[model samples]
Target: MSSVAARLAAWWHSGSRWPAVLLDAALIAVAGADLWFNRMPGNWWDDAVLVAGVLALAARRRFPLAVFIATLPMPLLMGQSAASLIALFTVACSTRNRWLLSACALVYAALTIAPWWGGSDILSESAWPVWGVYSLAPAGAAVLLGQLVQTKAELSRRLEEISEVREHEQALATQKVLAQERAHLAREMHDVVSHQVSLIAVRAGALQVSTEEAASKEAADTIRTLAARTLDELRYMVSVLRAGGGAGNGLAPQPTLDQLGELVDNAGMGAELEKGPLPELSPPVQRAIYRTVQEALTNARKHAPGAAVGVQLTQDDGAVLAEVVNTAPKRPAVPLPSAKHGLIGLKQRAELLGGAFEAGPTNTGGWRVALRVPLKSMS
Candidate 1:
């Protein structure tokens, strides 16, 4: 029973022409039979006029103005019809043509009153003023209704166009935001993997130069072990960076506050640590702190070798503050060897998690990086 009901509902909703055409044929047959039986004092042309005009209405959605034109000639040939008035309304509502609509209105007025005023039909006996009033009044009403429907359809079409434009604009904005996000994620991944590779290269080079047999063997074994670990770390970083779709590496443990000292030691930049009993922080905040320290130390070693770097972290009221400062190089300053993207990437990461970052040389003769992140961002 439910299946039958569903099928019936689907049939009713479907816009099939066969049903409407069959209905139009039935209506034409009944109207024809009625005209045949009631042989009024009208001309034989009335039968052809009535059926032909209304049957044209069945194709109104496809040729709306043509249906109105078909009906217009009938009114002139066989007098006024209520069905013809309805067809004029369909034309005005469906077709986007103003000149054709105005032409239709003028034709409707002329056709409605012409037979009564001059033709030798039964309507001619009716008083001229009364017959004109009766026929022209309905035609005028149909024209007014047509004008109103035209205005409504025009407004609806304009609204639909505006909605489509708004959707297109919103899609463009979303794509721009997505592109920026992907670029930022790419930079972050590059910074992390590059920092790790730099450490591996330096350590591996040191081990190759050592002379003591036992110590050299131990260092070589450590380098091999570190290389394997670095590969695993790279896979884990890629998985996190890709989120859902890329390499299916398993989840890795995130570095936290306890790992900060180890990260600075690994950089081999000879950093000096100073802290004032920091308060608890979110995991992402701890990671940011680690990344900032790691990058700053790497820059010092790369550009200002043998420079003493100072790393500091502290809690002041509600904010967690971090700073990494290094003595300026003995040589004159040169532009950092990068795509000018490190500071930009760092700023974006800081801002994304509701933090502030400042990186540049101080007037007092040293480079400094300072960051302040709010605890509430994690919450």
Candidate 2:
């Protein structure tokens, strides 16, 4: 019952005034016929006054203040009819213009009192007290109605703002859910692809070492190298998914400190390296350090071909640090193949492991990649 009533109230408030206009027109027609045909006590001027007041209501919403002002002459010209009082009340209830409502009230009040000084039909000798009562009543009613309109308008605006905020929040929540799903799908793909490639690489390497025929041995070596490269790509994909979800336990066999030398040599860059003992580290921290170096070397080769590159690793009291710095390319080269994703992925990996990653150009005109990972205490 409460919901039904609320809906009805909303419909009433938002509904156009055209239907109300038609009803007012019907009333004016009846009032005119009575005054003209039945020789009613009121003059035709009073009938004309009623018609004007009824027509003013149609424009109440569009120009509410003007509607109030248009009805001002009704009380003075026709000497205060009941219909005139209702029109004034309608204007106040429909409009939030307080100044216009207040002005209308003052003018109507003065006109009501005017009949007391002059001979007007509105105030009879026997009903002088009734005149003041009718005049003051609708004036007070108009003020209350205007306040109600103002309050309703403010409530409508607040509800609209709240609806917009709720819609925005819902959109953000949906995007987060979709991102998590994509990351989960990516994690599954990584496991299947990397495990298969690693197995193939291990088998190919064993075959190359065991083969007696030179031709067969060379073919096996080629297969092994291809498998290893494919495994590296799979590792990168897994790292991206893990970084996406803020979940680092996505896979096993992630390249670690042990693989740093192989990573540089395998890239065929003939890079020089310096090393330090690797402290035992968390799986995620080890992976982050590996990926940072791998991406640095890959970028160096692709952007600065034939330039000398250097990698340094150090383990101190609290952290494991790695830096890969490459010499600047002598010629203008095609800019590095930028996924624009690798560096961002690198940053996520470091942050997820409670470390920091920094990459940019060095002052001497070369690119540098540096990162620090927290180490498990040896003790």
Off by over 4 Å in 2: 1-47, 79-97, 118-133, 180-379
Candidate 2 lDDT over 1-379, as tens digits, reads: 9999997677666777755666566645653443345332467776675567656656665666676666665556544544445556666766667787777777787775664555565546666667767777768676686577667866775465456435534543564465578677777777676778888889989999999999999999999999988877777776666454322334445576778778888866669779977756765676677778877886776667557899998986588888999988754444322444557767877777777889999888889998887764222
Candidate 1, residue 328: how far the Cα is off, in Å: 62
Supply candidate 2's per-residue lDDT for 105.
Answer: 76
TM-score of each: 0.46, 0.43
In model 2, how large is the Cα lDDT of residue 229? 85
Candidate models: Cα lDDT each: 0.67, 0.68
The candidate scoring highest on TM-score is 1
For model 2, give the 10-residue run with minimal summed lDDT.
243-252
Error of 1 at 256 (Å): 41
Superposed Cα deviation of residue 82, candidate 1 (Å): 2.0
